[model samples]
Target: MAPTRTGSKRLLHDLNQSIVFNLIMEHQAISRIKLARKSGLPASTITKIVGNLLAAGLVLEVSADESSGGRRPVLLSINASAGYVVGVRLREATITLTICDLQCNSTYTRECSYQPGTAPQQVITIMATAIRDLVAEAGLTMQQIFGVGIGLSGLIDSARGLCRVSTILGWQNVELGPALERQLKIPVRVDNDVNTLSIAEHLFGQGREADNFLLVTIGRGIGMGIVLGGAIYRGSFGGAGEFGHMTVDVRPDAPLCNCGKRGCLEALASDYGIVRTALGTDPGHAIEDAIVNLIARAHAGESEIVAIFRQAGITMGIAIANLINIFEPSHILIAGEGLRAGDLFLEPMRQTIPRHTFDARDDIELLICPTSDDLWARGAASLILHEIFQSPIYEDEEALALDDLVSQASKAQKHHKK
Candidate 1:
């Protein structure tokens, strides 16, 4: 018993030590000098930390780069195979799951279809099973997994792990984090899918260097994620970027929105809106056929279709301009499936945005980019990695350890009572 207790204590201590060392491996590639500078710990403390990290195989010395005044200094980086995380994205009709290592390299990815009318519990079970299978296929044990992050389309209260509403999935008041944590026995983070995707782009994609930008996604629905001051703005109630719901048409006779509002931007400019307008002209028209017809009409200079797209573009531009007038982001990224008609929409949006923007800030950059379906799932995984690295663990090791100890004790007490 004494030996067992000693071993347990050593294991816990080593685990806590590894957490800090892993953070350095992920964030920086430098010698002890820069490591101490970045981590704000003394040289001796950094030496001890790196020594333990090296012994545990969590970090590796890549190469030595020479300083101007002295010999080359060895740089440290995360051992990519040290551990892995699972990211799951649940959409209206599909589920995407991915497994990634400490360095954010994806090991495997899988996609499964969900019934349109599936319940939240059913979706949760499917997601959990998919994650377990993917981790097992990767030959990793449960202890090797860092955590799980889930991204869903909806009004998500990320801080509280509650999804207040998911219009796409027809869900509301779902306790997503607690449910997943209970099943997976790992830390779980649930966030708005667009916000997650924006973070992923900010860290790993085109927005990596941009401190301020707006990520607008137009698809079955429309949404935007505001990145201000290098952090996602979740608003007062965690529903900050509902740009889609902004009213674009004040006419009472305009189309009704999914949220039961009339003439919303989503009802005017989304893919569904475009298709609906096209089909209204010819009742037997398929959506794809309508897209082709609309494109042809725009190309042939048909006034009606052109006017419809132009009106939608103007509304979209107004919304974007309003956001810019308030936040002054350096760039706005337009992405999603709806961008298939980029040529038709870009001109009108570009024209209208400048017209409405204050101070002639039409100089703000606007970029139209294409995104794949898996991007959101990858973003979810990035969220877990971000939290793991940027949390208080890297700053005050003792405080992090104490917090973990208290959490573990509380869980144990609840289990004993059960």
Candidate 2:
């Protein structure tokens, strides 16, 4: 369907606001003149936009800049305390909740675990409670929060807020977002965990300067998020970045993946794959203990353990090479909980990418960003923040009217108290 004239104008305004907000964040402190120049917007347009931003408390005016033979211009910077957002990251073993301010600084975090076979409602109740506790701990009400963003490992139908499939959590067609929204009475956005990481990278991490990048996360599962032309490339069904399911081998005896497939890259290189390999040498160790011992043995220079890590690296390298050859991203960031194995897995992975990559393509920067569950949670928070900036609240007359009414009420209350 074609966008209407009003819709087009609204979109333009949203884009302008986002562009201005990002500029202020990047430059730290910039004058209207510089913002207009950098953003290529007219001076009048910048002035109008800046006024809305200031009124919204998204940007603050700082000290005046040195003038070039004219009136000194005030600098503008992001208002880190303007509002807050909540991020929830759901994993197989645990669910993490975090509340972050406008600048994405985590002010509160809570974590709780759920055993396998636990009902989704049980997990949701725990998460909702944690969110409320975090908000109370921060001494803020729901009105102070912009929204909530959820990052989960699964085949997410983001538009519908459904987890179409999640092998890690054993979920199918789970209406996670709608269910949570009903409980929390707040706006919600849900996306694949790796996609959330991509949002974090684009806004705050290594991809801040690169328009094209791929983020590959390796941990309990393998996942990928692709950013192209400065936005997430969520294919037709929001499942475009399923890199883990790509076949790396077809050997009949290859270990099975959580998805029930055999010979997939994730089956060979993920944490599960590493521990499965370790079972041969550390015969009696449980899965959890086996992983701990696997890393220790590799660090201790055990040839057998070292070989297992090396093979994982080779499979990972193959995956990396394919991404580069297919996407040609300017940057490829490999991150997640599993990288704690240090260089035991990386050195071999690094050594294998060059062998398969096309000439010159192999030179693309590969960044191994060390991340934790908290970072992923922040990534989820970033998704909500990103949307808030793009929302039409700044341009919509009804929203502006509501804000004005709220402000008047607060003032009246304060005057009555005095």
lDDT tens digits, residues 199-224, model 1? 88777777877899999998767999
| Model 1: lDDT of residue 377 | 79
Worst 10 residues of 2 by lDDT: 397-406
**Against the true structure, whose TM-score is highest?**
2
Residue pairs in candidate 1 whose N, alpha carbon or C atoms collide under 3 angstroms:
none
**Alpha-carbon shift of residue 370 in model 2 (angstroms):** 0.3
Question: Each model's TM-score?
Answer: 0.82, 0.88
Top lDDT hit: 2
Candidate 2: C-alpha lDDT: 0.80
